[model samples]
Target: MTQITFKQGWRQLISGLADLRLAIILLLSIALFSISGTIIEQGQSVSFYQNNYPEDPAILGFLSWKVILTLGLDHVYTTWWFVTLLVVFGSSLTACSFTRQLPTLKSARRWQYYKRPSQFEKLALSTELSYLTLDQLIPELKQHRYKIFQEGNQLYARKGIMGRIGPIVVHISMLIILVGAIWGAFTGFMAQEMVATGETFQVKNIFEAGKLSKAQIPQDWQVRVNDFWIDYTQEGEIDQFYSDLSVVDLKGNELKQETIHVNQPLRYDGVTFYQTDWGIAAVTVQINNSPIFRLPMAKLNQEGEGNLWGTWVPIKPDLSQGVSLLTRDLKGTLLVYDTAGKLTGVVRPGMGIEVEGITLKVQKLIGSTGLQIKADPGIPIVYTGFGLLMVGVVMSYVSHSQIWALKVDNSLYLGGKTNRAQVGFEQEFLAILTALEKQQPQLVTSSSEKG
Candidate 1:
């Protein structure tokens, strides 16, 4: 009695896990938390959340920066609970596929030869033809592309078996997607770099990185920005831009090179570099009586004009009086300011402006390119899952169909069934019956051929 009880309990547990309801609930839970991860920015600095989702103004009055930190909301995808959900979902798919889909497919494949003509009444469509034999009926069923199985005076046939396998394929593809997402969550990293032209830099400044993704990070190779330039329309608005980039080995050998722009990116090994933003890093100018000097420019935030850089050039030895050189863009005007905070003059590139009784020439501006880089190991698997999903969806539409025929005494019994597209299947089944009806004339056939 105890052994039977344990067996029944175990079967009940398996049934519960394999239930469609359980799978739906788990899927909904995963989607809800995934949405939360998107709404609350992930991998932001502590100070960032502290400002936006502060303790007092706490977003939604309950979710503060502290709560995000404590609950690991910043890295929801890689968190234990999230991964656990993925694992459980995958397991549910496996269990459901094994317990339900596979068995359903197996049942579809295994044919049952109708031992009695009365079985035809159990089908959705059945009838008795007055004058039909095995030879006349076989040809009509053959035209319909059904595989035939026969015993003496009995017939079974089926087609569109893909409809049975389609569900299994869909379940397997879903499992593949879940595994890919979990893999990416544990092994992907995102980093941002602001590099000046002609400068080489290694991958660092990781804004978001997986816990075990150190190996996937670019460590051996470096990136060099050969040149950076922008294209502008007649209205002086940016039309597009380009960044000439190269992947370099540690020993100074070139690996891959390309001219990347917006919507275009450079890929090396497993990492991808995207041109995301741009900035001005420094300016070159000629101070009075000083060799053409290059001074680092500090970017400023101004009203109505966004991209602006400024630098103070000392015209006096005491460094007391200097001109504030403010620039609008790399190729635009430079505003000169006196020590009294008055805009003295406007100077274009290669032009001179009088400041503190001396001519200060604006020479050129150097530009910096901002690049965002990322590497995800599971992208291929994810794409493969997507392909499988499309194939499975198409296969699902084929319509699993079945038919049965039995000969009792001098009459041929015919019936049909389908798992989907029943109206279409019915039309085809009726057409086959009509064809058989035309050939219903009696014919002689050997009973030994029934095998």
Candidate 2:
């Protein structure tokens, strides 16, 4: 009795999980949360949320930094409730496949020949015909790609068995997709790096990462920015920026090298580096035959013009006086300013300007490349799942048709049915009957000749 009760409970659990309405509700809830994730900006800092979703004018009346952090809306895909939804949806698919699709496939695979003429009358399409035998009907069914089975005077045939397997494949594909999503959520990481020209560094500034993403981060490799440059259009506007990158090992041995631009990325060892931004890093300058010094440039945020970088160069050895040097592009031009915020002069690379009775020479401008790096281990699985899903959808459209026949006292009882495309299947059934009808006189004549 205990065993029976356990079995009943298990069966009921499976049945409840296999409910179509429940699956739809879970799917919709997942979509809703995903939309919220998109709208609320994932993986942003607390200060960013504090500024964007302030309490005084909370977005949607109740959305604020506190609410967002409490609900894990800052990273919805990795949230506990979101992941639970995915797991439950996957369980529902598995239960539906085992409890419904597999059983349906099993039933479709089991074919039987009807021994009684009365069996034909129970079909959706049934008719009584004269001058028909298994020998004449066999070729017609075979031409239509039916798999035939026989038992003395009764015959059975079926076609499109893939239609029965389609639902099962679809369920399996959906489960695979869910697994890929969960795996990516737990194993993938994203990071941004801004390296100056001729700089080599390891990935350390991780902005967003999963709990299990430590393995995905490169620990034994380093990336080198060999060079960074930009192309300008004829109108002096920026066109595109390029980064010459090299992948190296801990011993400084080069593993791979590539030149990447916007929409083109360098990929090595499962990690991809995408060129996303560019900036003026520094400028080289000399004062009155002094040794050349590299000055780091700082970016200034302006309202409407464009990007600008500036640096202050001290002229006096006492560190009491300095001149501000600013540039808007990497075209080697520098704008000099005095301590009183007055523009002194404009100079270019290899050109000189006298500042406080000393000649200041402007040299080359150094550029930096901003790269976004990511590693996703589940992409291949997701792609393969989608491929199987397409195949399953096409297979599901094919109608599974079955036909039965019994020879009884000089008359043939014929009937058939299909799971889909009812009108088309009826026409096909009539066409087969018409083809058998056309051969009747010829069969009789052949019989007479045989006699």
Candidate 3:
């Protein structure tokens, strides 16, 4: 007996670990972590932490490598503690269902009638009418579309007992989703890159920085950016942004092309790409002389540089000196130099400064375009979980009921019960009993005969 007690205790402990309470607690914890991730800007640079929390001792202390390593907060969801919590919750649910729920379901499936007077007295809806016998009750319940069952001197009636499994099914679906999420987090990869319009590069890393260990790009996919465009409102607010993207197969042939926008993402080979952002970038500069085409010279340079200078010597014998030029702030300064490279006067854009012999003018400023690239592999699992969760919720809210009847000594007894959605079930039960009274010829006759 002691051994049996010990075993039972151990089983209960295991079952409790897998209970819905544990799953709820774990889910709440995950929610907290998600909230924390949102509130704390992720993927920020080290300098961002320095700038944002400079004097905050706690933040500064948490930013240290030791604390990050110990807490695994850098990659919260993937951390051992978080994963352990998920595993424990999942195990608890499975254990609870296996040890407790399965047996309960089995017993519910077995035929057992409610006959105890004390039980009947305890019920919220109980009626004792002399006219109703077990036989009449059974047929009436059958007419009402309830599954009927009988035991000696007792009647077990049920309808929609299948609804009892709704919570379990929902829980199982959640477990599947959790498993998928964990699998993706461990094996899946995500990475982002910024490309100028018409520029492309292979994704070489999985994470923004050191948040998670880097993962390799999958072998079958090669992504390229064909074009990026941003449409803006008349008031200068951004209206929409999109990227034209192409995917190449392993053989270097284009497999697919798609236009992806902010919310609408491009999916290929189990991966999805989203257009996250766009920026101005990679500008080049050019210099051309104005008014006369004598010395046409063009120079290319990166934007935002401090200085630009160029010189042009005339080919004509009559023109002995060359023009010296400098450009700043979209303006040009021109100076003339003697054949010997001597001191010259300055000139600005559209204005000629007398130098060794000529005048110069500024021509153009060009701009480059930039686009943001991103890919996530966990989306499919997340979406599948969402779909199943909705289904489970709907099933749980719809109750299943059954009614049974038995005849003994020319008297009828009726029994009925539902798995869930009790209020609606009760209302339906009442409606069915009322219909039986009005429709059944023998039902009223039996009641009067008994009276």
Candidate 4:
């Protein structure tokens, strides 16, 4: 009695797991959580959500900063609930593929040769040749490349088994993609650096990292910005910029080098370095008859603002009178303003202009490059899953067709069915029937000879 109850409960569990409706619900739930992951910025500081989603006027009328933090909206992909959702969805796909798709594929491959005339009559495309035998139909079906099975006078022909395997492949591919996403969530890191020209640095400024991301992060290598420069248009407008970068080992031996630009990145050992933004690092100026002095330029605007660097150049030993020099970029244009709030002159690098009767020479401008680097171990696996998905979709287009033949008494019955493309399959079955009818006498003579 206990064993019977256990069997009943196990069957119920499998039934629930293999339900189409349940699988669809799980898929939709996964998509909904994925959308939330996209909508809520992931891997952000507590202050970020606090500043954006305030308490008085919330983001969506009820979503406060505290709510976002408690719900793990700042890092949705790595959250326990989100990972559980993915694992559950993957389990549903696996269960459905095993209990549903695999059995259907096995049923399609099984050769169920028709024995009675009524069996053929039940098919969508069924007919009988009054004077035909199974021998005639076998050759024509074989010519059509249909896989045939025979037992005495009965025969079965089938083709396009790929249709049976397609859904299974698609389900497995989605599972693989889910695994890849979960793997990457626990083994990827993103970092950013604003290195000046000719500066070598290690990966230190990490904005985002996964739990097991140490293996993905670079520790034994360092990167150097050999040079950073911008390409300017003829109208002095900014064009694309580039950074000459080099990767070195722990002992400072160069291993690889590349010149990266906007939309182009350097990749080495699974780590990618993208040239994102640029700024002016420093300015060299010669005032009056004095020697050249290099001064650091500070960005006047915050993040996302236009690049504008400025510094003050003192003209006297007492530092009482000085000119404020402002430049947009490393294009060598500097605006000189007097201490009395008067526009003085526009000077370029290597050119000296009289500012309050004192010669102010702009010497050289140094450029800095902002690079965003990232490493994800599961990216290759994700790409492989996508490739398998495409192949599976193509396979799904093939129709799973089955043909049964039986020679009963004086009549030979032929009928076939397909899981998809029914109209086209009907036309093909009719052609096969017509061929059998036209060669009825020859088919009977051949069958008699074989028997």
- Strongest candidate by lDDT: 2
Q: Which stretches of candidate 4 lie over 4 Å from their true place?
A: 1-10, 289-291, 302-305, 316-321, 440-451
Alpha-carbon deviation at 185 in model 1, angstroms: 1.2
Q: Least lDDT summed over 10 consecutive residues: which range in candidate 3?
A: 362-371
Per-model C-alpha RMSD: 4.1, 4.2, 8.4, 4.0
lDDT value for candidate 1? Answer: 0.85
- Candidate 4 weakest lDDT stretch, 10 residues: 442-451
Q: How would you encode candidate 4's per-residue C-alpha lDDT over 12-100 as one tens digit per residue?
A: 88778778898788788878878887888777788888888899898678888898889887778888988988888787788888888
Off by over 4 Å in 2: 303-305, 441-451
For residues 146-265, could you state the per-residue lDDT of candidate 3 as single tens digits?
Answer: 666666767766666556566677668778777876766665565666665554556664454322324424566677677776676898566887778888865668889898888888
Residue 188 of model 4: what lDDT? Answer: 91
Q: Residues 1-451, candidate 1: write the lDDT tens digits.
A: 9999999998887888898899999999999999999999989999999988989977788999999999889999999999999998898898899899999998998888887777777788777776577777787778889888888888888889998898899999998898888888788899999888889999989988878789999889999999888898999988887899999999878999999998999988989999998887777888776898878888787776677778888888798887788876666577889988899989887888877788888887778899999999889889889899989988988887888888878778888788888788878877876676556446432111010
lDDT values, one for every candidate: 0.85, 0.90, 0.58, 0.85
Cα shift from native, residue 357, model 4 (Å) = 5.4
Error of 1 at 318 (Å): 4.3
